[model samples]
Structures are given as C-alpha cells and as structure tokens.
Target: MSEKKFTKIDCKELKLGMRFSAPVFFDDGENMFLGEEKAVKNYHINAIQRWKIDYLLTYGHLVTDGKTAAPDSIYMLEDLEEVEEA
Candidate 1:
C-alpha cells in the first residue's frame, strides 16, 4: 500500500468531499465522527465553525488499507499528550 499524506488546513478552508485522515476532537477530546470517515459535509462544516475548530487534518486521497495516516508534526505528539492527561 502507498503511504498517505495529510495536510493541516484551517477549518475555514474546509469544503465538501475532503476526507478526514484522523478523527476530529473537541477540546475535551470528544471524537466528532458524525459519519463514516468523518467525511466533510455541509453541516459538519457549520458545526466545526460553530465549535471554533481552527485546524484539522485531511487528505485528498483515500487509504485503501483501512488505516488513517496522521500528519507528521511534533505538535501532534504534544496534542496527544495533552489529550491523554485530560
């Protein structure tokens, strides 16, 4: 299988058809998988804006291996630690 790449995009830039590479979460670490793969939809976009989510990870292509590819960044690790501590 080919490696998938994720790009960090501001929530404001999100649009329909962009597949989420990872589950989105609230500040309290609540998963926002409203649907399969958390596929972006009109309501999802509105909800994201209403929740004030500034950024999200998405990929233009799908992963056939059924594994989500996380973005490559140190900030992600820090975020994970914070979530674990919460």
Candidate 2:
C-alpha cells in the first residue's frame, strides 16, 4: 500500500497575500481550502484564528509573490539569513 503523508502547516506561517503552491486541506484532511488559484487574505486568517485552528494539512507548500516555501525548508539560521539576503 502506498502511504499518502500530509504536511501540517501552522497557522502562524499563514499570512496575508500568501498563495499556496497547491491546495491545502482542513484539519479533517478531507475538505480542501486554499486552492492555488487565489492568494490568502485577511479574513481567511481571521477565520482560522477565530476557530482556534492552529494548523492545516497539505501535500504542498506556500507560495508568496514568486517564492515557494516548503515545510521542510526549515534549516539553520545562517541559511535562512542567506535566503533573506538574496
């Protein structure tokens, strides 16, 4: 059997204007939310926070402007700083 692992996205990383690289599912892991078609807005974050949802499930990463942020992209502080400088 193949395993379909899901990535968890903390609500904290969600910000206004972040467009997902792919669709994201709700915590239920069934219902879909952020489709790549649209960028995130204030109300989306508001609703997530109001519902006390700390995280979301997805198979992809977040895209902002022209940058794609993978969940696994977390690395050393120096690397992050280097990215910021670029």
Candidate 3:
C-alpha cells in the first residue's frame, strides 16, 4: 500500500461547523479521532482545549456541502505533492 499523506490542523483554529472529508487521526496518524461527516462541534473543541492538545492530523481536507472549504482563520499547510503539481 502507498504511504498516506496527512495535514495537521490546529485545534484552536477550527471554525464552528467545520467538517472533514475523511476520518481525522491523532498525532500518530494511525488512531482515529473523528469520523468523516462529523462536523466540528463545541464538545470536540472543548475536549481538545481541555486536554491541552496542540493539533490533530488527517488525510482529508476540510469540506462543506461537498466542496472544499476555503481557508478562513486556518492557514493549512500545503501538501508537498499538491504544491509540486501546481
């Protein structure tokens, strides 16, 4: 299997109702944090802050209404492969 790529997102920067297109992973990138289609809620943010987590990683991009969400407060680091293609 090909190695999976990941994007690291800051917990404090996640906007209300933001959703991921794929399952979110923990720092290790193997453990699942939240499933796809699950919108970012108050509780999720609370837990991350309460636990003092710095960020989360995922193989998916942010989505809303089946489209890629535009960057707002979050400055998503570009995937190296994507940058190379551009």
- Give me the displacement of residue 63 in model 1, in angstroms: 6.5
Local lDDT at 18 for model 3: 85
Winner by TM-score: 3
Ranking by lDDT: 3, 2, 1
The residue-by-residue lDDT of candidate 1 on 1-86, one tens digit each, is 99545555666776665554365444333344333344456677788888777875444333245544344354358779999999
Error of 1 at 33 (Å): 4.4
Candidate 2, lDDT over the whole model? 0.74
TM-score of 1: 0.41
lDDT of model 1 at position 43: 70
lDDT of 2 by residue, 1-86 (tens): 99568899888988766766668878998888777545666678988989898888887766546654434234346568999999
Where model 3 places Cα greater than 4 Å from the true spot, the runs are: 66-86
Choose the strongest candidate by lDDT: 3
Better by lDDT, candidate 3 or 1? 3
Q: Name the runs in model 2 displaced over 4 angstroms.
A: 1-3, 64-86
Runs with alpha carbons beyond 4 Å of true place in candidate 1: 1-8, 27-30, 33-36, 57-86
